[model samples]
Target chain A: MHILLVEDDLQLGSAIQRALERLAYTVTWLRDGQSAIAGLADGSADLVLLDLGLPRRDGLEVLREARRQKVATPVIVMTARDSVEARVSGLDAGADDYLVKPFHLDELAARIRSVTRRHHGVAANRLEVGTISMDLATAEVSYRGERLELTRREFALLQALMERAGHIVRREALENSIYGLDTVVGRGALEVLMHSLRRKLGADAVQTVRGFGYMMPREPA
Target chain B: MHILLVEDDLQLGSAIQRALERLAYTVTWLRDGQSAIAGLADGSADLVLLDLGLPRRDGLEVLREARRQKVATPVIVMTARDSVEARVSGLDAGADDYLVKPFHLDELAARIRSVTRRHHGVAANRLEVGTISMDLATAEVSYRGERLELTRREFALLQALMERAGHIVRREALENSIYGLDTVVGRGALEVLMHSLRRKLGADAVQTVRGFGYMMPREPA
Candidate 1:
């Protein structure tokens, strides 16, 4: 899923970005609250990882402004403020989950899964479109109940497509969600990645829309 | 629903636009194929009413290019080209429904409804969200099974909001989908219309997101 990570700490942000990328998520890391507010208003990212302490503007102010502007993107607040009052304030400001700073990455991952599940109104970190089923928590994919092996890049690409299963995902959107904000990718990188994915899944698994992007059928071809 | 109408004939285009507006549909009327391709790619309109013969680019070419780009917006071809080969080619070029020229307006409206129903995979022209129900054909709206009386403007506005019941409909989107392309609306026009709707349905029927537009709950408030 596309995550807009708003954190000022370079070391913490870098660690979180790598951890999320390892988990097959594309990260757009911004270090200030002003930019976070603008990014959230764009309504492209599926989720937001917001830091309560931010530069230029306060994180709570950003959250309040976003909510007031009708941004329904789920947010998980990550901050050094571990006090009960801080937690309560974050929740009141419309945070989906609160993570105290210096926490384990594993806990952050769990929180991400739980938040996503709640958003999808599903019981677990599973997405089933037609014969394809994905266990996002474990990064496991199965076709018609048969286990399928996929490379990390392929898995990340498939996860993005699976999220919007039957709809057309524009090429730019795919690139933004699969690669980090600063990563420089070749022109043919996406097509090459798609080619390998199609070979493993099936030639008809992903349909290319010439100049636009790709679509995963509501039912398998 | 929003319809992108592409017809070069001034009389015909104006007639279709008026008919659609009378039915409470927001219409964006274009006069050529070049613009139609751009409109379809933008993906704003829910449906397109296309004419096959055009200047700059043929309607068939527009349809073919849009489909190639994965613009899955439903299109109903309204054209004088009624030969067997023409019909076959139109269907092959991704026209969802075809209508011969000089047809009745009622037929066009029916075609539009059928295309939308097919896209949504619904059996009838009805939308039910929570305790609210709307019959698009009859323009009838009810809350908790009781019929609610509404002005024409209010009904049109509510229809736009009901279409996206669970999500925040941006103010610009709502306006574009409810008013004709050339409409000049006052700043307070939407708010005034929304005020009456809220009064009839209940104070909490629609939630205002302050700076943003509005959201209707997935279920009754």
Candidate 2:
């Protein structure tokens, strides 16, 4: 997941950045509201962690502008300003969730998961296709009552494919999910990953859409 | 971004999880070596933040198992075992980076960014196509010297399209980038976003590939 973290506190921002990276998230940290708004306009982040008090532009204004411009990425407000009025206003401004300062990290993680899950229309953390079942929360994949041993990249690739089962997944999208978006992947890197996945899961597991991408058939052929 | 955090200490794990979430990372926190191994096997995380003195299975053993299984996700070892020998062994055991428990969070964030960047083969933080230019670091986009305002979703979609300029971006792929893999987006949501983008960037900025997807012509047709 990619996150846009907007905060002015150097100490807090740095700490949050480290913590998020430790949890395996790619974060783009901006210290001011103007940049935060600019960042949102470009759509590089999966979600935004917005702080209300910011330099150049207020966080609330940024949120308002984003909504005005129809930027639909979910936003979760995290600030020291903790009041029912503030929370209501933030939510009214289109913030998907709110977190007060000095809050537990687990709570933030849960809210992030919840908002994102709601955005994706995933009611649960589990996804299943055919005999392949995956628990997003546990990061476990079992095929036909037997667990499948896959590498991190392989598991990520399989999850991406299986999530959209019966629909073709563009190669570019698959590559982005497996590797960070900024990375310049070699031409054959994806093919190599796909080949490995096929070797383990059987050739009929993933279908290529010729010039486009790959798909996990609803009924594996 | 998705992270697999392997740490046995409850307080430390909780702290780390909070910090990461503030930075907008989606973290899967595991307290033991066995669950860490299982998590890695599914390939759900983009990277792993591993601790050596883990309960159940040693952190080093988890790393070794991941490597043996060809789980190539980058692993950053963070532990209190601060010895040259321990660091060397951790590196030898396939750790991409190492940090002491008393290390600065800022330093950890920088190292995580550095390791992930290297893994992704990203040498620079800027991407450009035609008159549209993007600074990946700042998440800024400009067209013909004019700063173009884009929503977070729009920016993501544009980045994906511009990155593969001249190639047809599969609709499925574009949708995945804009919304997320599991999001059951309304049929016209993408069209609406694209329409807005076209209005802002001019109709010629993006081209639909009929039944396939959309493309940004290399020559800007």
Candidate 3:
């Protein structure tokens, strides 16, 4: 998942950025609302973490403008204003979800997953294909009743495929989720990850859509 | 499909824009290389139709900058420069396809489809699922041996679904392809289109993947 984080506080922004990165999310941290708006307009990020109290332009205004422009990238409002009125206003302004300041990183991550899942119309964090099951919250994959170990990138790759199992997930989309947009990734990085993931899961667990991308078979053979 | 058209000539730009819109493509037209570069950086376009001769910055420079920034959006260069060397240089600069100006609009449209198909790793313009086949080049869909007529948006929606049969295509992705990113589409437009398509094809032709999107079964059920 790629997150465009609009937080002006240097310490908080850096900390959130690091935490999301650790959680395998590609984070693009911008300090103000203008840049966030521009980023959203250009479709640079898959999701947004907007802090309402922003410099140059208020984050709520940014969200409003994004919606006005019909930019459908989901936005999650993060602010110190914890009142129900504030939350309702943010939601009304087109924010998909809200996060109050002084929040735990774990809670923030959960909200991020929840909002993205809801946006994708997925009802839960657990994605399953046949005997293979994955818990998005814990980043755990289990095959038939046995737990399988996966590296961070491998888990991310699997999640991307499993999220839309039986569909060809584009190579670019997978790379964006695993390595971010600005990173110069090697051409074979995904292939390597897929090879490892397949070995651990099952030989027929993943299918290459040749030239397009990869897919997790809807019904494992 | 969304195309970022980078051309400086006002008459030519408008003509191409109108033609593409007529062909059901959502086009974002820019008149300079700098704006084109910014647009590409923000992932605003699905593909680029670029002119070599540009203002402020050379079109080649824009192409180079986009590649340097790790922007992998496919670009098709459209220019009056027809020399072998110029084509070679443009291809080296990461252009996916090339077209010389004073060309027929039909040929341009064909090349657009060809290039986008090649980029997606689709070897041909025809997509097939069981007895149903769609000729993207001619916009003709046939069920078994019977020909079926469809509206433009319906054709586009069916094409998107059939392109990756058996995979769940996200509703957002489908909407982006049908209505473009900036258009305010009605909520049930997709559902209505899918309903019409299913009626023509078969009740089991398309599967609703709940909130995520829709899919075409890998095998006819």
The best candidate in terms of lDDT: 1
To one decimal, what is the Cα RMSD in angstroms of model 2 from the true structure?
21.2
User: Order the candidates by DockQ, highest first — what do you get?
Assistant: 3, 1, 2
Clash pairs for candidate 3: A166-B167, A167-B167
How far residue A212's Cα lies from its native spot in candidate 1, in Å, is 3.4
lDDT for predicted candidate 2 compared with the true structure: 0.77
lDDT, candidate 2, residue A197?
87
> How does model 2 score by TM-score?
0.46
Q: What is residue B142's positional error in candidate 2, in angstroms?
A: 36
List candidate 1 stretches off by more than 4 Å: A144-146, A180-187, B1-221
lDDT of 2 by residue, B167-206 (tens): 8878866765555433477879989999999988999899
Best by DockQ: 3
Query: Of the candidates numbered 1 and 3, which has the greater TM-score value?
Result: 3
Query: What part of the reference interface contacts, as a 0 to 1 fraction, does candidate 3 reproduce?
Result: 0.00
Compare the candidates by TM-score and give the number of the best one.
Answer: 3
On lDDT, the stronger of 1 and 3 is: 1
Whichever of 2 and 3 has more DockQ, that candidate is: 3
Which segments of model 2 are wrong by more than 4 Å? A7-31, A149-152, A179-181, B1-221
User: DockQ, per-model, please?
Assistant: 0.02, 0.02, 0.05
